[model samples]
Target chain A: EDQVTQSPEALRLQEGESSSLNCSYTVSGLRGLFWYRQDPGKGPEFLFTLYSAGEEKEKERLKATLTKKESFLHITAPKPEDSATYLCAVQAGGSGTYKYIFGTGTRLKVLA
Target chain B: NAGVTQTPKFRILKIGQSMTLQCTQDMNHNYMYWYRQDPGMGLKLIYYSVGAGITDKGEVPNGYNVSRSTTEDFPLRLELAAPSQTSVYFCASRRGGTTDTQYFGPGTRLTVL
Candidate 1:
Protein backbone atom coordinates (compact mmCIF):
# COMPACT_ATOMS: atom_id res chain seq x y z
CA GLU A 1 0.00 0.00 0.00
CA ASP A 2 1.14 3.52 -0.72
CA GLN A 3 1.20 5.73 2.32
CA VAL A 4 2.79 8.93 3.64
CA THR A 5 3.81 9.75 7.17
CA GLN A 6 4.95 13.11 8.49
CA SER A 7 6.81 13.26 11.75
CA PRO A 8 6.83 15.80 14.57
CA GLU A 9 3.06 16.22 14.43
CA ALA A 10 3.51 19.67 15.91
CA LEU A 11 6.54 21.87 16.46
CA ARG A 12 7.08 25.15 18.24
CA LEU A 13 10.15 27.07 17.20
CA GLN A 14 11.43 30.34 18.51
CA GLU A 15 11.88 32.96 15.86
CA GLY A 16 15.22 32.58 14.08
CA GLU A 17 15.35 28.91 15.00
CA SER A 18 16.10 26.32 12.37
CA SER A 19 14.52 22.92 12.21
CA SER A 20 13.56 20.15 9.83
CA LEU A 21 10.32 18.23 9.19
CA ASN A 22 10.30 14.68 7.95
CA CYS A 23 8.04 12.96 5.44
CA SER A 24 8.51 9.25 4.97
CA TYR A 25 6.66 7.23 2.37
CA THR A 26 6.19 3.72 1.05
CA VAL A 27 5.06 3.61 -2.55
CA SER A 28 5.16 1.13 -5.40
CA GLY A 29 7.10 3.55 -7.53
CA LEU A 30 8.04 7.11 -6.73
CA ARG A 31 6.78 9.65 -9.21
CA GLY A 32 6.72 12.95 -7.39
CA LEU A 33 6.87 14.40 -3.90
CA PHE A 34 5.19 17.70 -3.08
CA TRP A 35 5.29 20.17 -0.20
CA TYR A 36 2.57 22.65 0.70
CA ARG A 37 2.05 25.31 3.32
CA GLN A 38 -1.45 25.81 4.65
CA ASP A 39 -2.47 28.68 6.87
CA PRO A 40 -5.48 28.77 9.12
CA GLY A 41 -8.76 29.16 7.23
CA LYS A 42 -7.02 28.97 3.88
CA GLY A 43 -6.24 26.41 1.25
CA PRO A 44 -2.77 24.93 0.90
CA GLU A 45 -0.21 26.82 -1.08
CA PHE A 46 2.31 24.98 -3.18
CA LEU A 47 5.86 25.13 -1.88
CA PHE A 48 8.09 22.64 -3.70
CA THR A 49 8.12 19.44 -5.71
CA LEU A 50 10.81 16.78 -5.69
CA TYR A 51 10.79 14.43 -8.63
CA SER A 52 13.66 12.13 -7.83
CA ALA A 53 16.01 11.10 -5.11
CA GLY A 54 18.97 13.41 -4.44
CA GLU A 55 16.89 16.32 -5.70
CA GLU A 56 16.60 19.54 -3.73
CA LYS A 57 14.66 22.77 -4.08
CA GLU A 58 14.68 25.99 -2.13
CA LYS A 59 12.71 29.18 -1.71
CA GLU A 60 13.87 31.95 0.55
CA ARG A 61 14.19 30.46 4.04
CA LEU A 62 12.81 27.04 3.08
CA LYS A 63 14.65 24.16 1.47
CA ALA A 64 13.39 20.71 0.56
CA THR A 65 15.51 17.65 -0.07
CA LEU A 66 14.41 14.23 -1.24
CA THR A 67 15.77 10.76 -0.70
CA LYS A 68 14.84 7.25 -1.71
CA LYS A 69 12.44 6.68 1.18
CA GLU A 70 11.86 10.10 2.65
CA SER A 71 11.98 13.86 2.25
CA PHE A 72 13.01 16.67 4.53
CA LEU A 73 11.80 20.27 4.71
CA HIS A 74 14.45 22.38 6.34
CA ILE A 75 13.53 25.79 7.60
CA THR A 76 16.47 28.16 8.03
CA ALA A 77 16.01 30.85 10.60
CA PRO A 78 12.26 30.73 10.31
CA LYS A 79 10.13 33.73 11.17
CA PRO A 80 6.71 33.99 12.71
CA GLU A 81 5.17 34.42 9.29
CA ASP A 82 6.56 31.01 8.41
CA SER A 83 4.25 29.41 10.95
CA ALA A 84 1.79 27.10 9.23
CA THR A 85 0.98 23.47 8.68
CA TYR A 86 3.33 21.83 6.20
CA LEU A 87 1.89 19.06 4.10
CA CYS A 88 3.61 16.28 2.19
CA ALA A 89 2.17 14.30 -0.69
CA VAL A 90 3.44 11.63 -2.98
CA GLN A 91 2.21 10.54 -6.41
CA ALA A 92 3.07 6.97 -7.15
CA GLY A 93 4.03 5.65 -10.53
CA GLY A 94 2.90 2.32 -12.11
CA SER A 95 -0.68 2.98 -10.96
CA GLY A 96 -1.71 4.60 -14.24
CA THR A 97 -3.96 6.76 -12.11
CA TYR A 98 -3.80 10.31 -10.82
CA LYS A 99 -3.86 10.26 -7.07
CA TYR A 100 -1.69 11.85 -4.44
CA ILE A 101 -1.28 10.17 -1.06
CA PHE A 102 -0.90 12.83 1.60
CA GLY A 103 0.37 12.94 5.16
CA THR A 104 -1.53 14.40 8.10
CA GLY A 105 0.83 17.38 8.01
CA THR A 106 3.18 18.96 10.53
CA ARG A 107 1.87 21.96 12.41
CA LEU A 108 4.66 24.50 12.84
CA LYS A 109 4.63 27.51 15.09
CA VAL A 110 7.42 30.04 14.93
CA LEU A 111 6.92 32.26 17.93
CA ALA A 112 8.36 35.74 17.92
CA ASN B 1 -5.60 35.45 -13.31
CA ALA B 2 -7.69 34.00 -10.55
CA GLY B 3 -5.89 30.67 -10.14
CA VAL B 4 -8.81 28.88 -8.54
CA THR B 5 -12.03 30.05 -6.85
CA GLN B 6 -14.78 28.38 -4.82
CA THR B 7 -18.19 29.80 -3.94
CA PRO B 8 -19.77 30.10 -0.48
CA LYS B 9 -16.62 30.56 1.62
CA PHE B 10 -18.62 29.11 4.49
CA ARG B 11 -21.94 27.25 4.79
CA ILE B 12 -24.25 25.57 7.25
CA LEU B 13 -26.47 22.71 6.16
CA LYS B 14 -28.99 20.52 7.91
CA ILE B 15 -28.93 16.78 7.81
CA GLY B 16 -30.42 15.41 4.58
CA GLN B 17 -30.20 18.81 2.96
CA SER B 18 -28.36 19.21 -0.33
CA MET B 19 -26.01 21.83 -1.67
CA THR B 20 -23.57 22.27 -4.51
CA LEU B 21 -20.06 23.65 -4.01
CA GLN B 22 -18.95 25.56 -7.06
CA CYS B 23 -15.32 25.64 -8.23
CA THR B 24 -13.92 27.64 -11.07
CA GLN B 25 -10.42 28.20 -12.39
CA ASP B 26 -9.35 30.81 -14.88
CA MET B 27 -5.98 29.16 -15.51
CA ASN B 28 -7.55 26.95 -18.21
CA HIS B 29 -6.33 23.84 -16.49
CA ASN B 30 -7.57 20.57 -17.93
CA TYR B 31 -7.41 18.72 -14.63
CA MET B 32 -9.44 19.70 -11.57
CA TYR B 33 -10.08 18.05 -8.22
CA TRP B 34 -12.13 18.30 -5.03
CA TYR B 35 -10.85 17.35 -1.61
CA ARG B 36 -11.96 17.57 2.00
CA GLN B 37 -9.73 18.31 5.00
CA ASP B 38 -10.59 17.37 8.54
CA PRO B 39 -8.87 18.06 11.82
CA GLY B 40 -5.67 16.07 12.25
CA MET B 41 -6.22 14.30 8.95
CA GLY B 42 -4.70 14.56 5.54
CA LEU B 43 -6.70 15.99 2.68
CA LYS B 44 -8.94 13.32 1.21
CA LEU B 45 -9.79 13.38 -2.43
CA ILE B 46 -13.51 13.34 -3.12
CA TYR B 47 -13.64 13.59 -6.92
CA TYR B 48 -11.64 14.67 -9.93
CA SER B 49 -12.04 15.48 -13.60
CA VAL B 50 -9.53 15.00 -16.37
CA GLY B 51 -11.45 17.20 -18.73
CA ALA B 52 -14.85 18.55 -19.50
CA GLY B 53 -17.53 15.84 -19.36
CA ILE B 54 -15.17 13.41 -17.67
CA THR B 55 -15.26 12.69 -13.95
CA ASP B 56 -14.14 9.99 -11.58
CA LYS B 57 -14.36 9.11 -7.91
CA GLY B 58 -11.50 9.51 -5.47
CA GLU B 59 -10.68 7.97 -2.12
CA VAL B 60 -13.66 9.54 -0.33
CA PRO B 61 -16.33 10.09 -2.96
CA ASN B 62 -19.31 8.74 -1.08
CA GLY B 63 -22.22 11.15 -0.61
CA TYR B 64 -20.66 13.54 -3.10
CA ASN B 65 -21.08 14.00 -6.85
CA VAL B 66 -19.25 16.21 -9.31
CA SER B 67 -19.81 17.49 -12.83
CA ARG B 68 -17.47 19.09 -15.31
CA SER B 69 -19.57 20.73 -17.99
CA THR B 70 -16.76 23.05 -19.03
CA THR B 71 -13.04 23.16 -18.57
CA GLU B 72 -13.21 26.12 -16.24
CA ASP B 73 -15.97 24.95 -13.93
CA PHE B 74 -16.38 21.87 -11.75
CA PRO B 75 -19.02 21.73 -9.07
CA LEU B 76 -19.37 19.22 -6.25
CA ARG B 77 -22.88 18.25 -5.17
CA LEU B 78 -23.67 16.84 -1.80
CA GLU B 79 -26.75 14.65 -2.08
CA LEU B 80 -27.47 14.52 1.64
CA ALA B 81 -25.45 16.36 4.24
CA ALA B 82 -24.07 14.44 7.20
CA PRO B 83 -22.16 15.48 10.27
CA SER B 84 -19.22 13.38 9.10
CA GLN B 85 -19.20 15.44 5.93
CA THR B 86 -18.60 18.69 7.71
CA SER B 87 -15.14 19.76 6.62
CA VAL B 88 -13.08 22.29 4.74
CA TYR B 89 -13.56 21.52 1.06
CA PHE B 90 -10.81 22.61 -1.29
CA CYS B 91 -10.70 22.86 -5.06
CA ALA B 92 -7.49 22.45 -7.00
CA SER B 93 -6.34 22.49 -10.60
CA ARG B 94 -3.26 21.82 -12.65
CA ARG B 95 -2.19 21.92 -16.25
CA GLY B 96 -1.98 18.64 -18.12
CA GLY B 97 1.09 16.85 -16.84
CA THR B 98 1.88 13.97 -14.57
CA THR B 99 4.18 16.00 -12.36
CA ASP B 100 2.63 19.45 -12.36
CA THR B 101 1.87 21.24 -9.12
CA GLN B 102 -1.78 21.74 -8.25
CA TYR B 103 -3.03 25.20 -7.41
CA PHE B 104 -5.74 25.40 -4.75
CA GLY B 105 -8.59 27.75 -3.98
CA PRO B 106 -9.29 29.44 -0.67
CA GLY B 107 -11.52 26.52 0.40
CA THR B 108 -15.08 26.33 1.75
CA ARG B 109 -15.85 25.59 5.37
CA LEU B 110 -19.04 23.51 5.57
CA THR B 111 -20.77 22.70 8.81
CA VAL B 112 -23.52 20.14 9.24
CA LEU B 113 -26.15 20.33 11.91
Candidate 2:
Protein backbone atom coordinates (compact mmCIF):
# COMPACT_ATOMS: atom_id res chain seq x y z
CA GLU A 1 0.00 0.00 0.00
CA ASP A 2 1.15 3.51 -0.74
CA GLN A 3 1.45 5.76 2.29
CA VAL A 4 2.32 9.38 3.01
CA THR A 5 3.17 10.65 6.48
CA GLN A 6 4.08 14.10 7.78
CA SER A 7 5.84 14.70 11.06
CA PRO A 8 5.27 17.28 13.80
CA GLU A 9 1.48 17.57 13.70
CA ALA A 10 1.81 21.18 14.90
CA LEU A 11 4.60 23.65 15.37
CA ARG A 12 5.00 27.10 16.87
CA LEU A 13 7.88 29.32 15.86
CA GLN A 14 8.86 32.87 16.69
CA GLU A 15 8.66 35.40 13.89
CA GLY A 16 11.73 35.27 11.66
CA GLU A 17 12.41 31.69 12.72
CA SER A 18 13.29 29.18 10.10
CA SER A 19 12.09 25.59 10.07
CA SER A 20 11.46 22.57 7.89
CA LEU A 21 8.50 20.18 7.54
CA ASN A 22 8.89 16.55 6.56
CA CYS A 23 6.73 14.45 4.28
CA SER A 24 7.77 10.81 3.93
CA TYR A 25 6.16 8.38 1.54
CA THR A 26 6.26 4.77 0.41
CA VAL A 27 4.98 3.79 -3.01
CA SER A 28 5.79 1.59 -5.97
CA GLY A 29 6.55 4.56 -8.21
CA LEU A 30 6.51 8.28 -7.54
CA ARG A 31 5.24 10.31 -10.48
CA GLY A 32 5.22 13.56 -8.52
CA LEU A 33 5.16 15.11 -5.08
CA PHE A 34 3.09 18.21 -4.40
CA TRP A 35 3.21 20.80 -1.63
CA TYR A 36 0.29 23.04 -0.69
CA ARG A 37 -0.41 25.76 1.85
CA GLN A 38 -3.92 26.10 3.27
CA ASP A 39 -5.20 28.99 5.29
CA PRO A 40 -8.11 28.93 7.67
CA GLY A 41 -11.50 28.74 5.94
CA LYS A 42 -9.85 28.34 2.56
CA GLY A 43 -8.81 25.55 0.25
CA PRO A 44 -5.22 24.60 -0.21
CA GLU A 45 -3.01 26.72 -2.49
CA PHE A 46 -0.49 25.06 -4.76
CA LEU A 47 3.11 25.51 -3.75
CA PHE A 48 5.41 23.30 -5.82
CA THR A 49 5.71 20.02 -7.66
CA LEU A 50 8.87 17.90 -7.59
CA TYR A 51 9.07 15.27 -10.29
CA SER A 52 12.18 13.34 -9.34
CA ALA A 53 14.79 12.81 -6.73
CA GLY A 54 17.45 15.49 -6.28
CA GLU A 55 15.08 18.08 -7.66
CA GLU A 56 14.36 21.26 -5.71
CA LYS A 57 12.04 24.22 -6.20
CA GLU A 58 11.65 27.51 -4.39
CA LYS A 59 9.15 30.33 -4.25
CA GLU A 60 9.58 33.44 -2.16
CA ARG A 61 10.39 32.25 1.37
CA LEU A 62 9.56 28.61 0.73
CA LYS A 63 11.82 25.87 -0.64
CA ALA A 64 10.90 22.26 -1.42
CA THR A 65 13.32 19.38 -1.85
CA LEU A 66 12.49 15.85 -2.90
CA THR A 67 14.20 12.49 -2.50
CA LYS A 68 13.30 8.89 -3.30
CA LYS A 69 11.56 8.25 -0.01
CA GLU A 70 10.92 11.64 1.52
CA SER A 71 10.39 15.34 0.85
CA PHE A 72 11.01 18.47 2.86
CA LEU A 73 9.47 21.95 2.82
CA HIS A 74 11.69 24.59 4.33
CA ILE A 75 10.43 27.98 5.43
CA THR A 76 12.92 30.76 5.81
CA ALA A 77 12.28 33.75 8.07
CA PRO A 78 8.68 32.84 8.45
CA LYS A 79 6.21 35.52 9.47
CA PRO A 80 2.68 35.46 10.82
CA GLU A 81 1.41 35.74 7.29
CA ASP A 82 3.11 32.45 6.50
CA SER A 83 1.27 30.64 9.26
CA ALA A 84 -0.96 27.94 7.81
CA THR A 85 -1.33 24.21 7.32
CA TYR A 86 1.23 22.71 4.93
CA LEU A 87 0.07 19.63 3.06
CA CYS A 88 1.96 17.06 1.00
CA ALA A 89 0.56 14.77 -1.63
CA VAL A 90 1.93 12.09 -3.94
CA GLN A 91 0.70 11.26 -7.40
CA ALA A 92 1.12 7.54 -8.02
CA GLY A 93 -0.56 5.90 -10.95
CA GLY A 94 -0.18 4.68 -14.52
CA SER A 95 -2.12 4.28 -17.75
CA GLY A 96 -3.79 7.65 -17.26
CA THR A 97 -5.26 6.93 -13.85
CA TYR A 98 -4.47 9.33 -11.01
CA LYS A 99 -4.21 8.44 -7.34
CA TYR A 100 -3.42 11.38 -5.10
CA ILE A 101 -2.46 10.37 -1.56
CA PHE A 102 -2.28 13.28 0.85
CA GLY A 103 -0.59 13.53 4.20
CA THR A 104 -2.41 14.65 7.32
CA GLY A 105 -0.51 17.99 7.15
CA THR A 106 1.41 20.11 9.59
CA ARG A 107 -0.19 23.14 11.22
CA LEU A 108 2.38 25.86 11.72
CA LYS A 109 1.93 29.05 13.71
CA VAL A 110 4.48 31.84 13.55
CA LEU A 111 4.10 34.27 16.42
CA ALA A 112 5.01 37.91 16.11
CA ASN B 1 -9.77 33.36 -14.33
CA ALA B 2 -12.39 32.08 -11.93
CA GLY B 3 -10.33 28.91 -11.57
CA VAL B 4 -12.36 26.35 -9.63
CA THR B 5 -15.53 27.44 -7.86
CA GLN B 6 -17.89 25.65 -5.47
CA THR B 7 -21.29 26.85 -4.41
CA PRO B 8 -22.89 26.93 -0.94
CA LYS B 9 -19.80 27.99 0.97
CA PHE B 10 -21.45 26.72 4.13
CA ARG B 11 -24.47 24.44 4.63
CA ILE B 12 -26.30 22.56 7.33
CA LEU B 13 -28.40 19.49 6.70
CA LYS B 14 -30.45 17.25 8.90
CA ILE B 15 -30.19 13.49 8.80
CA GLY B 16 -31.68 11.80 5.72
CA GLN B 17 -31.55 15.00 3.72
CA SER B 18 -29.95 15.20 0.30
CA MET B 19 -28.09 18.00 -1.41
CA THR B 20 -25.82 18.64 -4.35
CA LEU B 21 -22.55 20.51 -4.16
CA GLN B 22 -21.83 22.37 -7.36
CA CYS B 23 -18.31 22.72 -8.80
CA THR B 24 -17.24 24.56 -11.88
CA GLN B 25 -13.96 25.51 -13.47
CA ASP B 26 -13.08 28.01 -16.16
CA MET B 27 -9.50 27.03 -16.95
CA ASN B 28 -10.45 24.36 -19.48
CA HIS B 29 -9.00 21.70 -17.27
CA ASN B 30 -9.82 18.17 -18.33
CA TYR B 31 -9.69 16.81 -14.81
CA MET B 32 -12.02 17.69 -11.94
CA TYR B 33 -12.16 16.16 -8.48
CA TRP B 34 -14.23 16.18 -5.28
CA TYR B 35 -12.65 15.72 -1.89
CA ARG B 36 -13.75 15.86 1.73
CA GLN B 37 -11.52 17.18 4.49
CA ASP B 38 -12.07 16.35 8.11
CA PRO B 39 -10.60 18.20 11.03
CA GLY B 40 -6.92 17.33 11.40
CA MET B 41 -7.07 14.82 8.55
CA GLY B 42 -5.95 14.94 4.97
CA LEU B 43 -8.27 15.44 2.07
CA LYS B 44 -9.93 12.25 0.89
CA LEU B 45 -10.98 11.90 -2.70
CA ILE B 46 -14.70 11.33 -3.23
CA TYR B 47 -14.84 11.23 -6.99
CA TYR B 48 -13.05 12.45 -10.11
CA SER B 49 -13.72 13.02 -13.77
CA VAL B 50 -11.19 12.95 -16.55
CA GLY B 51 -13.40 14.78 -18.99
CA ALA B 52 -16.96 15.12 -20.09
CA GLY B 53 -18.97 11.88 -19.70
CA ILE B 54 -16.21 10.16 -17.73
CA THR B 55 -16.52 9.82 -13.98
CA ASP B 56 -15.03 7.37 -11.53
CA LYS B 57 -15.09 6.56 -7.85
CA GLY B 58 -12.27 7.60 -5.57
CA GLU B 59 -10.98 6.70 -2.12
CA VAL B 60 -14.11 7.76 -0.21
CA PRO B 61 -17.26 7.42 -2.24
CA ASN B 62 -19.70 5.55 -0.09
CA GLY B 63 -22.07 8.46 0.37
CA TYR B 64 -21.18 10.51 -2.66
CA ASN B 65 -22.07 10.44 -6.36
CA VAL B 66 -20.81 12.67 -9.14
CA SER B 67 -21.60 13.46 -12.72
CA ARG B 68 -19.53 15.29 -15.28
CA SER B 69 -21.77 16.39 -18.10
CA THR B 70 -19.34 19.04 -19.37
CA THR B 71 -15.75 20.07 -19.01
CA GLU B 72 -16.64 22.98 -16.81
CA ASP B 73 -19.08 21.44 -14.36
CA PHE B 74 -18.66 18.49 -12.01
CA PRO B 75 -21.07 18.27 -9.13
CA LEU B 76 -21.12 15.88 -6.18
CA ARG B 77 -24.36 14.61 -4.68
CA LEU B 78 -24.81 13.32 -1.22
CA GLU B 79 -27.67 10.91 -0.54
CA LEU B 80 -29.18 10.65 2.93
CA ALA B 81 -26.75 12.99 4.64
CA ALA B 82 -25.40 11.61 7.87
CA PRO B 83 -23.48 12.99 10.79
CA SER B 84 -20.33 11.31 9.57
CA GLN B 85 -20.71 13.16 6.30
CA THR B 86 -20.02 16.50 7.91
CA SER B 87 -16.85 17.83 6.40
CA VAL B 88 -15.29 20.62 4.41
CA TYR B 89 -15.66 19.79 0.74
CA PHE B 90 -13.21 21.02 -1.86
CA CYS B 91 -13.41 20.97 -5.63
CA ALA B 92 -10.30 21.06 -7.76
CA SER B 93 -9.32 21.06 -11.41
CA ARG B 94 -6.12 20.10 -13.17
CA ARG B 95 -4.95 20.32 -16.72
CA GLY B 96 -4.49 17.29 -18.89
CA GLY B 97 -1.70 14.75 -18.27
CA THR B 98 -0.65 13.03 -15.08
CA THR B 99 1.31 15.64 -13.19
CA ASP B 100 -0.35 19.00 -13.37
CA THR B 101 -1.01 21.44 -10.58
CA GLN B 102 -4.55 21.26 -9.20
CA TYR B 103 -6.35 24.51 -8.52
CA PHE B 104 -8.91 24.36 -5.71
CA GLY B 105 -11.94 26.39 -4.81
CA PRO B 106 -12.51 28.05 -1.46
CA GLY B 107 -14.36 24.94 -0.19
CA THR B 108 -17.79 24.37 1.39
CA ARG B 109 -18.19 23.61 5.06
CA LEU B 110 -21.06 21.18 5.61
CA THR B 111 -22.51 20.11 8.89
CA VAL B 112 -25.04 17.34 9.36
CA LEU B 113 -27.18 16.88 12.41
Q: Per-residue lDDT of B1-113 in model 1, one digit per residue for the tens?
A: 97899999999999999999999999999999999999999899999999999999999999999999999999999998999999999999998686778899999999999
State the TM-score of the second chain for every model: 0.98, 0.98
CAPRI verdict (incorrect, acceptable, medium, high) for model 2: high
Candidate 2: misplaced stretches above 4 Å?
Answer: none
True lDDT of residue B35, candidate 1: 95
What does DockQ come to for candidate 1? 0.82
Evaluating just chain A, the predictions reach TM-scores of 0.97, 0.98
Best by DockQ: 2
Superposed on all Cα atoms, the candidates' RMSDs to the truth, in angstroms, are 1.0, 0.8
**Candidate 2's residue-wise lDDT over A34-104, tens digit each?**
99999999999999999999999999999999999999999999999999999999998776868789999
Error of 2 at B81 (Å): 0.8
Candidate 2, residue B49: lDDT: 91
TM of each candidate vs. truth: 0.98, 0.98
Which residue pairs overlap in candidate 1's backbone? Answer: none
Report the error of model 1 at residue A19, Å: 0.6
lDDT of 2 by residue, B56-86 (tens): 9998899889999999999999999999999
